[model samples]
Target: MASNYLLALYHKTLRLPFGRQIFSRMFASKAPYFKTIKPLITELRPGYCELKFKKRKAVANHIGTVHAIALCNGLEMAMGAVAEASIPKHLRWIPKGMQVEYTAKADSDIRITAEIPAEAWNIGDIAVAVNGYKADGTQVITGFITIYVSAKPKR
Candidate 1:
């Protein structure tokens, strides 16, 4: 199978100074909504993606905590990265649904993560695990996003 472009780019660029930043910016541009959170992709591999974002007024709710929607956005960003990096070359994926739980208040910078087992990428619904952690490792959000994977449509 062919190597995934996103994964290959990540490996190639992460070594250069500021290359990770460039890659993150380009990645978020593909899904513009993710830019709203000022995401930083800290890790990207075949079956996992991790990112971080700082909390600020724009992302804070009325109580001065990071809003749930902001957490969801971060989770989605990580999930999209993982899906694109992990899927087989012959397959494609689209998000079908997301189910998440707000477990704790997001009081600091958040680390979001998405991971999938290699065998899970098949022609069916795949529930990818996602979570957001506070600076001190407290899990502020937990969830799974379902993605529909199938063979790429013929040209």
Candidate 2:
């Protein structure tokens, strides 16, 4: 089977000095909502994706911490990439819902992660585990996003 296009692009772009940023912006352009997080994608591959974003004013709350919504946006971004890279060639997916728990203050740059098991891909609600952590490794959020997966229609 052909390799996933998104995954391939990530690998190719990673060869450049600013490839991750280039790829991240390109990916966010596909769904503009994700652009708000200003993500720096650290890793992308089948079944997993990880990204980091700074706690800048745009993403900061009134108390000077990263906003919860920004974290959710990052989670969704990572989860979306995971689904696209992991699903079978003949299958497609859309996020049905998200459930996340905020645990600690995101006072610094945050790293977000999304992961799925090889066996979890199927024609149903597939839950991808996602998490957000501070630069120091303190987990600030943890939860999962549910994506509805189904067979693609024959063209």
Candidate 3:
């Protein structure tokens, strides 16, 4: 499954339009964030993805800490990258569900990491778990993302 998806990504890169190719390369340089927040993808691969998000005053709720939704944003960013890198181009995946556990206050930068199952993963429903922590190495949030993967129908 890992090899298959990597091959597909390589193939898809070749098929992308000239404009998209350039755009993708640029986007790959910087990870997109939620609204005003910009998360950076520090690491990404077929079976793993990691992103860093800094806490900002705007993202802070009345409690003066990172908003709960902002933590979820980091989780989604990590999981989305894992799905994008792990699933073949012929298939698509969506977040079916998520369970978050916030353990600490995120006052600084938060790093989120998601790992895909190793070995050959069969086509079907899958769940990816993402973990986020503050700069001090305290756990901040966790999420489980359910993804459905299936072959796209013929045109």
Candidate 4:
């Protein structure tokens, strides 16, 4: 298992004040869509990633609740972070599809967590489980993001 560059950068940048903001901004630069939700990576390690975000006007729906697409974006961001840390350097991955369920209304800040199973390391489609929870520990959404894993092409 090689060092995960994303995790390494997270550790290095987290030592300074406002580092999480800096990290999020840097990440948004690469994936501009993530900027809409203002996701902050709170934790990242092998097989796991956690991201937190607030329900702002930008992410609100017609009824003023957190929009479904916003939650999906947050889920994808967490899943991507975990996948990047979980896969070996020799392998490559891409999101295949996502199945999600909206269990409850999201009216406040929320946290999203994604985890990869140990069995998912074998070459194939891996289903990563992602869940969104509110401040009171209530689950708002549950999702499974399938990612295609394969060997990296030789340069």
> Tens-digit lDDT track for model 4 on 1-155?
23878878787888889998888778766778988999998888889989999988999999988999999999999998898877888899999999999999998898999999756787889999999998888899998999999999999
If candidate 1 were superposed on the true structure by all CA atoms, what would the RMSD be? 1.5
The local distance difference test score of each candidate is 0.93, 0.92, 0.71, 0.89
**Number of clashes in model 2?**
0
Clashes of each: 0, 0, 0, 0
lDDT at position 100, candidate 4: 99
lDDT of candidate 1 over 35-111, digit per residue (tens): 98999999988889999999999999999999999999999999999999988888999999999999999999999
Once model 1 is optimally superposed onto the true structure by TM-score, how far is the C-alpha of residue 80 displaced, in angstroms? 0.5
- Which pairs in model 4 have colliding backbones? none
- After aligning candidate 4 to the native by TM-score, how far in Å is the CA of 108 from where it should be? 1.0
RMSD to the true structure for each prediction, in A, is: 1.5, 1.3, 5.7, 1.5
Q: After the best TM-score superposition of candidate 2, give how far the Cα of residue 148 lies from its true spot, in angstroms.
A: 0.5
Better of 3 and 4 by TM-score: 4
For candidate 1, the 10 contiguous residues with the lowest summed lDDT are 1-10
User: Between which residue pairs do clashes occur in model 2?
Assistant: none
By TM-score, the candidates rank as: 2, 1, 4, 3
Clashes of 3: 0
